[model samples]
Target: MVDRPRKPSALATTPGLPPQPQVAFSADNSSVTATLPTGESVSVLLYGATVVSWKDKKGEEKLWLSEAARLDGSRPVRGGIPLVFPVFGTAPDHAQTKALPQHGFARSSRWEFLGKSTSESTPTPTTPAFAATATSAAGAVAAAAADMSVKLDFGLSSSGLSEDARAKWPYAFNAIYSVTLNTDSLTTNLVVTNDDDKSWECQVLMHTYLRVDDITTTTISGLQNATYTDKTTSPISSSTQSSPLLTISSETDRVYTPAGDSPASVPIVVSSDNKPKFTILRDNLSNVVVWNPWVEKAQGMADFEPKDGYKQMLCVEPGAVGTWQVLEPGDAFEGAQTIVLGGKTE
Candidate 1:
């Protein structure tokens, strides 16, 4: 059971205003949920700081979770947006990440819940993309706070790691992940700091799994003409995307990178029957991965739940995985991605 704060603060009950959004923790303190006054809500588990659920105002889920996903801290949650850090995938040839598990330890490690805050803002952030804006903007500038939003912060540091995980990657580092929920969108931001005396190299990815009515009716737009590495191909092939919209019919795993004058922050749309369903906008994250395990691959994964679940979910991940980022001691790297539901057409 979750412990919800039912007592409304005096200001929240003010005569003409709507009740402020509320954030609550589970009775066991293993997870937390934030609910907007309008009825949208999001929940995050401490293990890996994985977002387990995100519901719209009408209670429709936007993110998918595998039925077989292990939520007991035995492994990483297999859905929603799993944070991949230090390494994107298996790197047997790299000296720095060779010993670390695929996608590093961030996803499987437990994170400290730093707390929650609420604010009011417009749909678009000031910096546009890849930046942290005011949380509790309602408190700082009460007069300007109109539309309500909520944010939850989670933290992980080297000192909090288990003995075996610490031994594999000895660098001291700190990671902060923020999940911000608005009326019509969800935004996630990650900041990594090299806390060790020596510099280190790493990759970060927001591996987002979006729920859809049917995969066959879905098409992704915005990568046309951009170059992508087709990981599903033997020897891995790279080519420009010739189609304005891409669909998944078979096993697909391609990482798209911007080429020529293509901007990295361009809006990527996932549509169903030519109508927009989700719009992804990213900043400082140069790569986008479009993947679907399809039939064979989906059946082979132990935690993928029903073998046919692939038809109901798609992984449209925004990441900084095309190249490694080297951070100097005391330096930090930040990246963000925002997913808007029922996006507007161009």
Candidate 2:
């Protein structure tokens, strides 16, 4: 058995606020930072998270996660990894969506970060050294603190669940999300537990937005021969049988399933015409979703890119589709995905 390091000391908790357990870890050059309150964190490449945010470097009050990746620009500050549960995207029947707003209420909600001392079991592997590095970096933010990496946990509260959420889907469920940044990559893990007596069914996903210098010039692989569904058209089409590999042209929206049962370990390499490659490795996920609002649609989104901003980024999500996952009373379900930076291909 791999020797797990001792759990760090108790996190300093703020009175009247949810337990904000912040921890830190460090390796050599890279560091990670996590806040248990929001499960929000940052990985300092010593360079930048991914792309350099000119706005952030200038000391503007810009949201770090906003410029980092996965921050739902349109939603509240509880950003970074917006947890989409009970459903992803829109419901098959548009009428059924009236009660819910946007992407089913997890993003804007605040979560409680169960402190570091608490023991939790998860399907994914735990890297204590990496967690340490992350937390240590966070400490550096304070003038008197040391450099380290940290891992934080957040739990969903009844109050945190939005009114819109209750109107659309009424069920008791608890979700715990953790974000950990290591020297080489960022890992996000989500666990949902059903508290109600009846089994519940719903689609689940992690909407990840990646920052790039130029989307038009970036070439993304891993979907070659993989199957996908085009959301633009009501009737889903298979990219595998017809349009196998996907390269961004104008506007694109497609959901893909791995070619086989093997986890999608292959890097979804994204290379710009002249820049480095950003590799996305998805694991334990059933589907991959690629989307871009394009010209007219981009304008429709409250916080999406301007008509031309579509050329800056792409959303390649890892999710479960078509059928909704059913969780029985007291049962919990978990899934994980990873995004690694640097290392471009020729």
Candidate 3:
């Protein structure tokens, strides 16, 4: 079982209404933050519904975000969870993806705030013609100390997309993203329904950036012995990880694809000095993309900023990248990843 910090419960001594999530605007009012009672909270932007920050009960960030990350809606946010959909990092058979944005329009395109699961917000996240049923949603977010979970859904569809985006990939679809926050872990669930007659293949990923004291000092487990395509190499060679503790000392980019008979829930352990800080459990996501732009590459990118910002963060993404997830007509696909905080033995 997962181990979380033993927090004192106040409900037993002081009786009151269960603290509802304060779904309010940030001080700047440009973004919204869901402040959970458990002291763990997540901030999101209405622009792309991009999750910008997720903090634990101690108010420490589990995710790594660039100091220069933009929130003006000009481009895809540089950090947090930049939703990658329809296509992932320019694949082979996706003809339309080449012409459109880098990781498909989902991240770049604006999404409508369909509101909360309760009546306070809108009923659903779709347009008048395509709102889906509640089955698209999973369990709600659990309080920092409470038993029940809190859930909020965001709607994005072909109809709600911009003209330029719709012209690029014409497929009727409803994408309902329900973000449920638990006491120890925050779950991101993506439910995609193909409303069109033709089937389509796509890739989706939560390009998650994790924060660390130093990138080079951390070792990532759970991927050892798995086959991976080394993108850092010229010809892109594939190899099996021999080391039980995979350490990153230089510029690294690799995609790990497990065997068909591998365990369904792969636990990727992130640790410092042999003590785990947190564990990322990926469900239905067989691939893990590990990347850190070390020196020269970090200087060239405008988003990385400060020239040496790569030392503080790492991207250990879980998604369907090696192969594609196909959705037939009227079919729905659900994929999720849960990040459970470790003992914090720092």
Index of the highest-TM-score prediction = 1
lDDT of each: 0.87, 0.56, 0.75
TM for every model, in the order presented, reads 0.88, 0.66, 0.83
Off by over 4 Å in 1: 1-12, 121-146, 260-262
Ranking by lDDT: 1, 3, 2
What TM-score does candidate 2 get on C-alpha atoms?
0.66
**Local accuracy of candidate 3 as per-residue lDDT tens digits, 29-93:** 56677766667788878777788888877898877777787788888888788888988887545
RMSD (CA, angstroms), candidate 2? 11.6
lDDT for each residue of candidate 1 in 166-194, tens digit (9 for 90 to 100): 89889999999999998888999999999
Candidate with the larger lDDT of 2 and 3: 3
| lDDT tens digits by residue: candidate 2, 1-346 | 8765895777775442233335553464333344333233453221112211211222321112333233322343322345666667667574434456556666555455453432222111254433444455332222112212344455674455667667677788887776654333556677888888888776667776666677777767666677667778857665562444456887788887767667455557666784445566765577878877778787775555344667776777777664677788998878777666555322
> Candidate 2 lDDT (Cα, whole model)?
0.56
